[model samples]
Target chain A: MSARTLLRVLPPVVLLALLAYLPYLSFSVPGVLPGRVNGPGSMQLLATCLVFAGFALSYDVVFGRTGLLSFGHALFIAAGSYLLTVSLADWSMPLPLAVLVALGGTTLLALVVGAVALRVGGIAFAMVTLAFAQAASIIVLRDPAGVTGGEEGKALARDAVPELLVGVANAPYRYWLALGFLVVALVLVRLLVRSRAGHAMAAVRENESRAAVLGLSVYRVKLLALVVGSFLGGLGGVVHALVLGGSGPHLTTAEFTLSLLVMVVLGGAGSTWGAVVGGFLYHYADARLTEASGSGVLDALPGVLQSVLAQPLFVLGAFFVVVVYFAPSGLTGLGGRLVRKGVRT
Target chain B: MSDLVLVLVTGLGLGALYFLAASGLSLVYGLMGVLNFAHGSFMTAGAYAAWLTMDALPGSMAVGLRLLVAAVVAVLVGAAVGVLAEAVLIRPLYRHHIQQVLVTVGLSLASVAAVQGIWGSDPHPVAKPALLAGTVEVLGARLPVDRFLYLAVALALYGGLLALLERTRLGLVIRAGVENRTMVQALGIDVRRTFTVVFGLGGAVAALAGVLYSQYAGTVSPLQGGSLLIYAFIVVVIGGMGSLTGTAVAAMAVGLVQQLANYYAASGIGDLSVVLLLALVLLLRPSSLKGAAA
Candidate 1:
């Protein structure tokens, strides 16, 4: 490899190496993590963050790269999560078969929903996807025949799963699984974006009519992006279920999908690394902010102010608005600008 | 037969609430090309405003009088919020449709969370006038009096909106802008002001819907606006974006379908059927819903 290529790749490689070694570390981040880096609590949090990072990156494939503003990305994730548990607990499927069923079912769902939703372009497409997702959410919440466990959500069937993935002592294993999922997702997304289809998606995003005039099948390219993005998102959901031990009704809300949008935008859309960073930071902040809210510092504030700051979502949402106004390109874009400015100075 | 009457009247009432919510959404989307996610926040704010108003009033005050005052406060608050949001959050990012939508999304999340933080997530019982709380027999079916109030208020708003759109100078400009904003701008009209006005109007109507919805449910919660917003969104889409008449028609259909299905079939089936209706509408009559203006 050339010197420039080596320089470009070295930082991420080092970062990944450090992350992989995290479970062995004794370091604790006060106020940031609940325990030492190697402890179960911290490991589980990190694993959840990694899964969300992968999920946000998958969303970016459609939202940033392909310019499809879907409000129903949560549906596929929920499908993966609910399907995995159902297959294991109810259908009596083995671990391997259950995983396959979850992933395969999610992918097939994405294809079918995409094909139908893609028929209408722009905001209509968003609404259609949302409607489909809302339908799925209703079905899940209703828990037809009691398979989904309804509002309480279904727990992972321990007996149907492997032993290594079950207990708190095996958090590192789950963390590793989460890391592996992120790496796989990153590789797949990178591969997809580097392909001919990726270029077509970009063209379609820029101007569908012009792309079509240039002999590109706009519809097919969009469908491909949605399918790929959703498939990866489904993978994230599977990892999320494993790391968290179960999927809740929270996963099925439109708010979850919107949060993914916030993460992608916060990290800077259209860039894989930006999404990962955004997703990781968002999940980390969401988890830690609740802790911070109860800390002594917030107690010093006046009643109304303290109450307002107590909700992590309020802070994140306000920050998102500020970012939208000032940092339209997101944190990554802001960083790039700062770097460019430094060089100029 | 009595059950049918109750369901039908109740459906119309629900449809009225949906219309109140969807009308503003339709107008804003029609003229501004913004899907205001914060519209739900506006509803929540209005509901809380009314709740606070009623709570603050002296206990000696008549319940009916207190509610009337609360309704006015809610409407005014909703209008003010709508205008302020448009001027501050929306006007800055003119022409950037996605960013506009995203900002609204952020606003919705932040405001809703703030409300939740302050009030807690649980539903709070809303006080109602004895008249509104009572039931009226209609066609041998005892129906909640609030349902009729919903219908009356919705019809008044609908008629008021129609007159404003069809009769006034501002209405003409708004209508013209929705049809072709550039053309209206080319004619030396400041369409931006109309955007703000439309937003304020939409907000007021949405707030009114929120108040009425709270009355219907007999409770107010931070999440109340969100659940209702989904149906409102469906109504807007099914009716065709920006067409007030279409929104009203679609709202009633969705309401009736939801009520009838919930009653006839399973409980949650109504919600599912409404979605199925949206899908069918989009699939079968895609062109009809495309770029339709007020």
Candidate 2:
């Protein structure tokens, strides 16, 4: 290949090599967990976030590109998760099969949800999706006596072996797995957003009336957007179930719900990488805040707030207010501004 | 039959609470177009205030004194929130709807944290005044006197608000401002002052609801405001934002529907009935229910 072609493929080629060689260190190092580093709990959390990154990206596509606020994207995740679990339990399906089923199931679910949600544009979509999410969550929470394992959650019976996944069997391995999916998902999203579909979605979001007058099928475009969004959401669930080893109803925690929204807003909502980067920043900050509480330095924050400010939610709450009140463009937007100014100079 | 009646009364009482809680929210939406998610947080704040003051007061105070104390505390706190939020947070986003949404979301987050920090994440209980705590026989059934009291307080507040909106010069300015803010401002009237006044009034009403609900439930959870805000948004959309009568009517209907739903459907599907009703409403009369907001 020419030097130009070589340069284009070099980064991903290098990354592949690095991942292949990472297993060597796990065995060579004395204290490392034989083939990987990092514990299970965190591996699961990080993995879930990585999968959520795809969901967020799809959301950014619709929200930023189409001005369609869909709060029920959570339903897609739930649907995908349930499908994966059932496939594993009933069919003893391999992970790939499970993922395939989940993607198809979620895409179909997305079609249904989008059918109703897209019927009305703007705020109406948001309300409908929100209502759907609430109803779906309640259903999941209620089915505990049998299929769902209820509040307890169900785990996949099949084991994920090291040989099955480049011969590593821990969270660090799972983290790499998750990171791999996230990278691919991110690249795909970036490509899609640069395509004609992306332009059409943007056209509709910016001005539906104009797009309609131009003869673009607004409804069809919206359907495709939501379907893509749902597919990503399900794919995320597949990786989430694989890396985390378990799933449940409470997975729809308020913190996760609120934080996901905050992350999208914080990262400036539109860009693909913004979703991934925002996920990391938000989850990391939240984890750190919870751990750091009562450590005397920040203890004063909660202690002084008449003893009620000690919770990590307070920190999140404060962050929300500051950002909303002051930085409407979000951190990514600010970064974009700085970059623009620097280039101009 | 008795159980049905019980659910009906309970739902109506809770609906009044919801309506009262939503009053400030709708008003804020009307005057400023801000959703005021923090309206629920303000209710928690008022509840906390009432609890704090109750603890501070040693002897048993009269019912009137307690109500006065709670109302005053709510009004003062509400006014502070209104002014500070308007000046520092919301003022910058004036007429910019997107910024208004972002800032309000942030404000809600901040308020939740502030309250949690002050009260601890643990639930705080507010004691009902002894006079209001006991129940009375009404319509051949034993009823929680406080429920009727809330209903009474809500009606009184509504009456007073209607009078204020209709009879006073401030009211005329507000009405004129809501219909056409630019026209009033162009006529040399101070719109900023009007915005501030309406915001303060909205906050006060929300705080009052918070205090009343707290004493009635005898507990304040952090999620109190957050969850309440969700229902209020639905109710407002249903009732038509900025329509006082619409808010009251929608609030009661939702209250009854949800309460009855909770009574019959297993805890799992209890919330479903309301959602189903809302869905039906949306399907049939989407525009009429949500009014102009959607």
Candidate 3:
């Protein structure tokens, strides 16, 4: 490849390499980075972070790039997880087939949901999506089918997953599987954003009426984005289920949706790479704060401070409020400004 | 016939709670074009305030008097939180729905965390006042006295709010502002002040709902507000975004559907039915609902 091409390829190549070997690095560096790298305890958190990175990137495709603010994004992720879990646990399907079924089912779901949601634009669309998601969550919790395991959630038996992807005993392998999915997600989203359809999505987002006036099928563009974005979201769910060995009703909560929103917003909405960065930062911070709160390190502090630290959601909320108010464009926007200033200097 | 009466009355009772929860949300949406997701948090806050007040009061006081005092405290606390939230959290992001959603969601999460911090994750039981704890016979059926009280209070609130919006100078200004904020601002009125009041009132209303509903259900959990927020959103959507009357009607309808679905179908079908109804309505008649704000 030419130097220009090499330069273009270098970042993703480096990222892939780092992610692919993260478990090994962590395992080898027990002294430098104790719990997080030395064992399954922290590697499990990293695995989840990888899954969420894919999910957040998919969300960025709609919210960041297409300017479609969807409140029901969790439904896609949960659908993928739940479908895969049920197929494996109930029907005794192979892992590969279960994964295939999940992706296809979620894509169709996105298409149907998108068709209904896209009929209305803006805030109405958001509300419609939220209502659908709420309904789905209620169904999951109700679990009339006796399959979802209701509030306790459904977990995979060791035999249900591929031996390589089973958690704990083969934690590093699970991490690699999650990392591979993230790579697939990144490549897919990058390609989508650079394609002709991607340009169409941008045009529609910029101004729906104008795009419609100019002969762009606004509905089709939106539906296409939703379909592709949700497929990626489902893939994230598959990774979530595979790495964690289970799925739960918690996957469908509005709080979960907000967390995804925070991840995208904290990273910068329209930037694909920003979503990945934001996802890693968010999950890492969340895990660290949760660990700190439970670690009893704050016991020496004042009672009120101890109470505040003990509840990690409060910290996450405070972080979100600060980010939206002071850094609306998120870290990516901040990075962009600094680069621009450097060029000017 | 008694079963029908029971269903209708029970659903209306639930509708009354829905009205109390959603009216403030609808008003804020009308006035500011922002959906306050943290509205439920305010409700939870109100419930906690009432709980605390009742806990602190002298045990020998009359139940009715104690109830009134607790409600006042709850409303006051809710209003204070509202003012503080509006000033600090919501003031900067006016007219941006997406930003408003993001911030309020954050606020909601923060509020949930705060609630969990203060109250812990356990559910607290709100004992109904002695007078409202009795059962009453209506049309050959037994019903709790508190349900009747909730309906009466909800109706009175609905009527009072209507009069305030239709008959009072402030209400007229609020209505006019919702219709055209820039034009109202150009007329030399401090629209910002009106919004602050609206935000605070919205908080008070949601708090009242929280207090009363917790008393009605006999339990208040830290995370209850998050789930209730969903039902409120459904009411707002079904009734038309900004229409108080529409909201009332929609709430009743949802209440009826929920009660009936619970009776006739599987345990969780009620929520599913409401959402499906919303989808069908949106699909079939997106523009027919008259109270769309934007």
| Candidates sorted on TM-score, descending | 1, 3, 2
Per-residue lDDT of model 3, residues A10-50, tens digit only: 98899788767676654445423337673786667777788
- TM-score (chain B only), all candidates: 0.98, 0.92, 0.96
* Candidate 1 C-alpha lDDT tens digits along A1-345: 999999999998999999999999988988778989899999999999999999999999999999999999999999888888889889999988988999999999999899888888888787778878888888888989999888999999888877888899999999999999999999998988899999999999999899999999998999999999999988888888888888788899888988999999999989988899999999999998988887767988899889999999999999999999999889999999999999999
lDDT tens readout by residue for model 2, A107-147: 98888778766666554455566666777776676774467
DockQ of each: 0.77, 0.45, 0.70
- What TM-score applies to chain A of candidate 1? 0.98
Question: Which scores higher on DockQ, 2 or 3?
Answer: 3
Query: Model 1: per-residue lDDT, tens digit, B1-294?
Result: 999999998899899999999999999998889998999999999999999999999989999999999999999999999999999999999989999989999999999999998999999999989999899887789998988998999899889999999999999999999888899999999999999999999999889889888988889999889888888889988999989999999999999999999999989999999998987887798887775878
Model 2: chain B TM-score relative to the native chain B: 0.92
Runs of candidate 1 with Cα error greater than 4 angstroms are: none
What's the true lDDT of residue A59 in model 2? Answer: 63
Report lDDT (Cα) of residue B109, candidate 1: 93
Candidate structures ordered by lDDT, highest first = 1, 3, 2
Off by over 4 Å in 2: A1-49, A86-105, A119-121, A141-169, A248-250, A253-255, A294-302, A305-312, A320-328, A343-345, B62-68, B289-294
Model 3 per-residue lDDT at B29 = 88
- The reply for model 3, stretches above 4 Å from the true place, is A26-38, A342-345, B289-294
